[model samples]
Every structure is written in C-alpha cells, then in structure tokens.
Target: MSTATPPVSGKLFGLFCLASYLLSLSYGSTFLLSLLISSRGGNEHDAGSVISAAMLSTFAAVIVSGHLSDLLGAARSVALFGVLLVAASLGFALTPGFGHLLLLFGLLLGLGWGVFYTLGPIIVASLVTPTQRAKYFALLSGSMMTGIGSGPLLGRAASAFGYPVTAAFYLAALASLIGVLLFWRLDRQLKQAAVQTTAVSRISWRSAGQVLSSKAVFPIIMVGLGGCVFGGLSSFQTSYAAARSLDYSLFFLGFMSAAISGRMLIAGFVVKRDPFRASCLLSGLMLASIVMFGFVVDSGFTYLLAAVMLGVGYGLTYSVINGLAANEAPNGTTAQSLLLFSLSYFIGVFGFPLLAGKIIVEQGMGTLLLTVLAVASLNWLITVGRLIWRRLSTTRALQRA
Candidate 1:
C-alpha cells in the first residue's frame, strides 16, 4: 500500500528491456498471420476476423490481467501470459489447416500480448524517477520497436531462403520462451532487492470510472485513433503492396527505422517539454504521411518515404500519448488508467482491420487508404483541439483568480 516509488536498478531495467524486446518480437512475427491464413486457403475476411478475435481477446486480457497482477504480482502474471503466448506460437506453427482452431490460437496470442504490453510500462514506471520517465519510456518503446521491426524482416529472410513462412512461427515460439525466462529472472532479482512493484492493492469499478473520466481520457482517445491508423496499415500492408507491385517489407523497414530512431533520439527531448504540442505536431506529420501513402506513393522510393514519415509521426506520437496517459492518471489509479489506455488502443488496432477487410473487398485498397487518411486527420484535429482547450482553461482559471 506504500505510494513511494521504488529505487531504480540498472541491471533490472536492462533485464526488463531485453524481455520486452523478445516478447515484442514474438508478437511482431505474428503480424504476418494473414499470410498464414492465405496459405491455409482462408481469405481476407477470414484473416481480419481472426485478427479481430485476437484483439478482442487482448482487450479482455488487459482487464483481467490488471487484477491478476495485483493479486499474483507482476512477474507471475507476466510469466503466465508468456507461457500462453509460447503455446499459441507453437500451435500456429504446427496446426495443419486454418479453421476455428486458428481463431483459438489468435485469442491465446492476444491474451499474452495484453498482459506483457500493459505490465511492461507499469514496471518501467516503478523503476524510474518521474524526471527520468520520459526518456526511459521512449527507450523501452524503442526496444519494443526494434524487436517488432525485426520480425517481418526475419519472415522475409526465411522466405528468401525458400523456407516456409510458417517456419517463422517456430522462431516466435523460441523468442517468447526466452522472454518468459528473462522475466522470471527479473522477478527473482526484484524479490531479492525488495523492490516494491507498482501493482495496486485492489481494483474496483469506482476507480475505473474515475480513470475513465480523468485527464487520461485524452491520451486514451488519441492512442485509440493512432491504433486505428496503425492497425489498418499494418494489417493490410501485404495486400496493398501486392496491388502496387511493391514489397511489403519496405513499409516495415521504413516505419520501424524511423520510429526506432525517433524514440531513441528525439522523443524524450521534445515530448517531455510539452507533450500536448508535440503530439499535435507529430499527428500533423502522420496525416501528411497518410496522404502521401494514399495518393502519391507510386514508386518504391515514395512508398518508403511515406513509411518513414509515418514512422516519425505515429511512432513518436504514440510514445508521447503513452507518457501523457501515465502522467495524467489520477493518484492511486495508474494501473487502471493504463489498462483503459491499452484497451482503447487494442480496440482500434484490432477492430479496424475487420472493417478494412470489408472495404478492401468491396471498394478496393484506394477506399481503404482514404478511410485511414480520414482517421489520421481526425486524430490530428483532436490533438490540436485538446492543446487549445487546455491553454484556454488555464487562461480562464487565472482570470477568475
């Protein structure tokens, strides 16, 4: 029940980062689940459905795991989900054909992702001083981005060597298992050091309600919008590339490269100063990138350019929003606020693909891009609006005084 922040340890932080990277690599490898569905005779709709199912499962998992973390402790909760993730990856590799079973595996995969993704930030928040959180958060995100970005390239390499794409799933399983072990070690170290984790003592509807209505709502909404843009683009990049006679890997390469660099080098400095204004600028960049991708990206060079812009824009924007969510959280409700943040983001990331699949099937990729562009525009507008509102509110309060 103590509210004091735990003392940071350099060794434990490194272990957490390594585990996060490996776990993210496992999740990122599955980004190509659409290809797996195709190989098994499933179509776009089927792929979308499976992905959405996983996302919804993630949504549920975030809520459930938040409570479980409080009860069982962060390390145990993470390990349990990590085991589920490993099992799901193995199942994807070994499953004979795509069917309802694939949906089941997807759900399992999502459940694992929800836990790790939510808890990773909580652990970092506990480890770092408030003044250092922005840098550390960006660094943590950079580690995750590096792993995620590498996953698709690994799949591409396997394909280049004429290995079955499914072979990547086996690698994913291995990465996840390693992540679990790393977390286990981290837990032991924390216990030995007697580091107090950020886990809350209890969760309740009243606290959840307060978090929902708190300033955290702004970041939650922004992240959800960003999630929609990310989900729509990443989930369907393969199809879009094929339609344009481009390699899908280019998108991942450019996006991950820019995103990683920005998080590592740029995000901490800019975002920590004025997160709201930074979000607005980055959101504008994201909108421009989407516009270029949707309307002007004909050559591979242009495609990569758009992807890079998106990487800078959305990637940095996400980190800023994440920090905002944590900083703006009401006292005693950081865990719940972050839980909602994860849930909102999952909804957009996993939910949009279902609609996007339908749009691609009926209206084509052009329509899909336009829709995503619209979402990007809306996200930017919201960012700008929130910043303006906050300034006005501050000015009015001073006037009243």
Candidate 2:
C-alpha cells in the first residue's frame, strides 16, 4: 500500500491563482476606495464612516455566507460570489458621485466580500489534504499579504497610468475576473455532483444552534478584539512615522516583507509543535511589538525595527488564530464558523480604524498608536489569563486522577 499522497497540481494551482488575483485586486480596491473618498471632497471623518460602513455590512453578511456555503459546496458558492463582487466593484467605479460610492461600499462590497471571505478558506480546505493544510494555508496567507502590501502601490501606479479611481477599479475587476475564471476551471475538476445531495443532507439546525451556544464563544470574541487592535496599528503607523521624521514607505515596506516571511516560516513550525502554546506566545509577542512601535523615538533604524517586529508578531499570532478557528469549527458549521471568526475580525477592522482616525483627528497620531498598544496589551492580558486558567485546570485534573 502506498502511503504517499498525490500532489494537487492542476486543481490547487487553479485555486491559488484565483485566491491571489482576487485578493490583490481587492487590496488595490481598498487603497483606491480610500483615495476615491478623499478625491470626492470627503473629509477624514467621511472617509472613515464610508469604510466602516462597508466593513460592518461585510461582517454581517459573513454569517450568512458561511451557513450557505456548507449547505452548498465551497467551490460553486465562491465562484458565484466572486462574479457578484466583480459586478459590484465595476458598478462602484462607473457610478458618478459619493452617493454611488456609498451604495457600493455600503452594500455591494459588503455582500460580495462577506461571501468571498467566508468561502475562500472553505474552498482551500476542501482542496487540500489534512497533512498539507498547514503549508497550504501559510502560502495562501502570504499571497494575500503580498496583494495587500502591494495594493496601494499598484493603485498609485494605476492612477499615474491615467484612470484615476477608474483605473483602480479596472485593475480590481481584472483580478476578480481572473479569479472567476480560475475557480471556474477548478470547478470542472474537484466538485462531485453525486456528493451534492449528500452534502445538503448533512446540514443540521441543531448542530448550528449548539455552535451558537458554546464555551468557546468568549475566546472567539477576543479574537475579534485583537483583530481590531492589530488593524489599528496599521491605521496609525504612517501618520505616526511622519512625526518622528521617518521614511514612511521604507518602514511600511519593511513591515510587509517581515510579515510575509514570518507567516511563511512560523506557520509550519507551529503545526509541528503544539499549536495552542505557540499561538498564545505569538499573540504576546504581537503585544510586545506594538509597545515597541509606541516608543520608537528614532526614524532611521528604530522605526524599521519596530515595523519588522510588528510584522513578525502579527504573522505568527494572527495566522495561527486562523488555523485554530478552523480546528474549532463544528461538523456542519465549517463555513459558519469560518465566517463567525472572520465576522468578529472584520467588525474590529471596521471599527478600530475609525476609532484610530478619530483619535488622530482629535488628539494626534501618537494618541492613536498608544490606543493600539493599549488594546494589544489587553489582548495579551486575556491570552495570559486563559493560559493561567488552563494550567490550573490541568493541575486539578491531575490531582484528582
């Protein structure tokens, strides 16, 4: 009997292409979205509101996306969802004014992203073997980060290319269009028609309800809070750098490179060791990194060091949480659980950036960075509390035994 598993050459490649291209476009659209709002004569407050609204709407829809995905299969749902997002994104680009921007950001992006974000992971999980999951996930995450890190730069280049906001949308559309095609190709291979009926039969209300009520809920909620705090650091970083006479772009790029490398390296190691302990330690490291970011008085090397620390910390901590969330998923609640965890993160994403903006506007960017550090510290505290509880429980159980 052969113990070796076959490599997912054709199908997985197709899926990776889809994920990479789509996320790249999406990230570009993110930068363009911010710029578009600014170009339309909207102030910082208005921009924050628009972005926050889009994210909140996306978060709400993620719940539905997850449930529906398991009911349907992961691949078909993702394909259909991607197409809808393409249309919505294109429409947003074509629309004339801020009202149209509101319509797209508030509605289309939300619905589209909710579905896309929820299903993307499900599809990846479906395609790979359990043994390959760690490597696959790390690579997948790195690709998304690449897209994100390059997004604004691409958008700027696109704007320089002459389409202004329209160019960004076009780039985004092309990315999604490519994603749609890649998935469509893979759909031909991986999806089994006979299993569709069996898949639908597996869906259960009781299972979902049980999931809704669980001891794990509180811990999951903290993941969301941590996400917001992490995002807040990015929201305030550039502005903070300006105060310290830093080269913002260099510091930013250093963080991005470190983050990508960290995710790629740390993910495999964590899977080999104990995931639980690894994640908690990484989360603590992220908190420490934020503190480093907070106190950097020098712009030259110190700022770069701070960004790299933040990158490494987030790379390990945030990526591990994603894997843990996958492990925690219930039988039928694969998509739902995926979205639920993401839902919290996105909510934090939407709110925290705005919160940072408010602080920056009212007090200063330094205040906003402080806010991120404070939130990160809280995340560490919560993680430590959980660790302490676990140790105590283990001691008691051993004593009783």
Candidate 3:
C-alpha cells in the first residue's frame, strides 16, 4: 500500500477519530430527550416511537448509504452526511414541538449516524496496510465509546447549570460542526497527498444482491448476533441495578470502561490470530456474564464483575468481527460488505432491545435473561462447531495424503 492514500497522516486520522467521537456525542444526547418530550405533554410512548423511527432510518441508511458512498466517493459521501448531521443537530436545538423533534432526531440524525459508520471504516481501509487495520478499528471504536460515555455526563452538567435540556442539543450541534470542519480539512489533505484511487463500481440491484448473498459476507453477519446480546444488556442495565439495589452509574462505569479497554488491548491479538476461536471464547464469557446478572444478586461486587465481563467480551467481539468483515471486502465492494455488517449489527442492537423489553414486561427479568443466554449460547456453539469441523476436515485431508 502506498503511504499517501489519504489516511496515512497521524493528524488526519486523529481528526477522523475526533469526528467519530463528536457524531456519537450527538447521538448520545437523544437518550436525554425524553425530558423535553415530557415537558411538552408527551409521554414515553412518543419517545419510544421516535427512537424506533430513528432505528428504522438508521437501518435503511446503512443499506443505501454504503452504495451511495461507493458511487459518490468516500470523501463526498462523508461531507454530505456531516452536513446533514449539522442540520439535524441545529434542528434538535431549535425545534420546540414533539413532531419536529421526531423528524430531526429520528430521521435526519439517524441518516447522519448511519453514513458516519459506513464511511469511517471504508476510508480507513483505503489509508492503511492490511496488518494495521485491526488496530485502527480498535481506536475508532474507542473514539465512539468516548462520545457515548461523555454525552450523558454533559447533559447532566447542563441541567446542573440550570440550562434547559435543549442546551444539550446546542452543544451537540457545535461539536458536530467542529467535526465537519475537520473532515473537510482531511478531505483537502487527502487530495493534496495525490494518492492513487480506484473508481468505485456503480451500484445496481443485481450487484447489491450478489454482494449481500456472497459466502464471505455471511460469517460477518453471523458475527453480529453478539450485538443482540449486547443491546439487551444496554437497554435494561439501569433497571437491573435498581431491582438489585445497586448503583446504576457504578455498574455502567465498570461495563463501559471494561469494554473500551478490551477493545484497545485485546482486539489486536484476536485479529492477528484465529478470530473464530476468539469469538467463541468471548461469547462464552458473555453468556457467563449474563448468567451472573440474572442469578447473582448478593452485592455490588457481582454487578461489577458481570458488567466488566460482559463489556470485555462484547468489546473484543465487536473488534474481531469488524476486522474479519473488512478482510472480506473484494476490490470495489468494500463499502457494501461493511454495510451488511453494520446492518446486521444494528438489527440486533435495535431489534433485541424491543424484544427484550416486551419479554420483560410479559414474563419477567428471569425469562428475558434466559432468552439472552440462549441466543448467546447458540452463537458460541455455532463458532465452536465451525472450528471443530474445520479441524476434522484438515485431519482427514492429511490422512488421505
């Protein structure tokens, strides 16, 4: 790989990471918008509907935007999405009515978020050697975590200062704009570097279908099943803490910090070795963690242990699956494969929360957790089964020889 393919400069890549962090910060503010809705005579139903809408938009955008990124070029696509993000953030700050917030937060912001995830990896892929991909992916994932972890804290601070909840949106808009400016500068720098670039294939329905149904892409999607397990945990951790008389903040702190650390520290090793084995091991840990959450209710120590276990497990899972997917990108179809990976991931992220929420209401936490356990256990079983089958086939071939 040439040294000048757009992402070589440490400063430019750092800026890209900053942009990712800011985009996620804006996304995190959406979690605090229920208060704004309540102040306007709206209810949790409205908030749920808005959130569901955003998830739907995010799903659709990931599918379409990846193809669009291929056609329009990564720099242009990212620029367009960044502009939409700026507009959405401003709308969030200025829109007073619940309906408008739905449009801005649900549809527009979701579009921007989808585009950001789709392009970030594709751009990074173009910039680095194959060996370095996993490390950078780990770094970008950490950047996103930084934004997610910090956004809520900032929202709390704004409330402490007697600022209306809308202030969070304003701050998000400012951060987003700064991120956009940095992206624009990076785009200019890429052009100035004069790297050889390939022309992306024009997208068609047939081409999209072929990419989606390709064998290389299937494992990538399967890897994303872990996200369903994670979404369930994220959606109910606060309630779980309350039920057990534990501190929600402390539980989350352990979970998110451990997840971030695992991605940064353990992901490189996983990607360098057998990703399937890593997947099986980490998923077993996730299953164990969920079991702890369900049955162990004695002390805060259990909460800490479960959260950290879950975090480290899923964190490594996230990085390994992404690195594996990126490795499968054939020539001009990198964006499309990544889109599938993101789509499968968000399906779990969005779908499982709703599923788990309903199950919790109808049955109980015990049943909901059992459901998570079943899904996670199945994931581990499939990976382990594949590994065993591969080893058996290799041994048979050796005997024949």
lDDT of 2 at 389: 82
After superposition, which runs of candidate 3 have C-alpha atoms over 4 Å from their true positions?
1-7, 33-47, 70-72, 86-104, 156-169, 191-198, 201-205, 212-215, 329-332
Q: Compared with the true structure, what per-residue lDDT tens digits does model 2 show for residues 1-401?
A: 12134255644654665466574566435544545655766544554565566676775567566556556555566667777667766775776656635645546666666676656666566656545555566667676676666655555566567857567676777777777666666664655421122133122456546555753454466667776775565544445555677755555576778878887766667666665577678777777777777774465777778778777777666666666666665655554555566677778866676776677678877777677777777777776777788899999999999
Output the lDDT of residue 243, model 3.
67
Poorest 10 consecutive residues by lDDT, candidate 3: 193-202
Model 3, TM vs. native:
0.84
lDDT of each: 0.82, 0.63, 0.70
Per-residue accuracy of model 1 over 86-156 as CA lDDT, tens digit each: 88888878887778887898898889988888877776766656555667778898999888887777788
Better of 1 and 3 by TM-score: 1
What is the C-alpha lDDT profile of model 3 across 1-401, one tens digit per residue? 44224346777778778878887777666655555565777654455455455567777677667567657666667667877677776776677767845654567767877778767776766666666777778878878876765655566678789998778778887887787777766775654542334355234566557666664464565656786887666655545655677765555577778877887777766778787788778878887888888787568887888889988887787777787776756666655666777767767765566567567656777888889888888877877886898799999999999
Clashing pairs in 3: none
Error of 3 at 251 (Å): 3.7
List TM-score per model, in order. Answer: 0.94, 0.83, 0.84
* lDDT ranking of the models: 1, 3, 2
Better of 1 and 2 by lDDT: 1
Best by lDDT: 1
**Cα deviation of 81 in candidate 2 (Å)?**
2.6
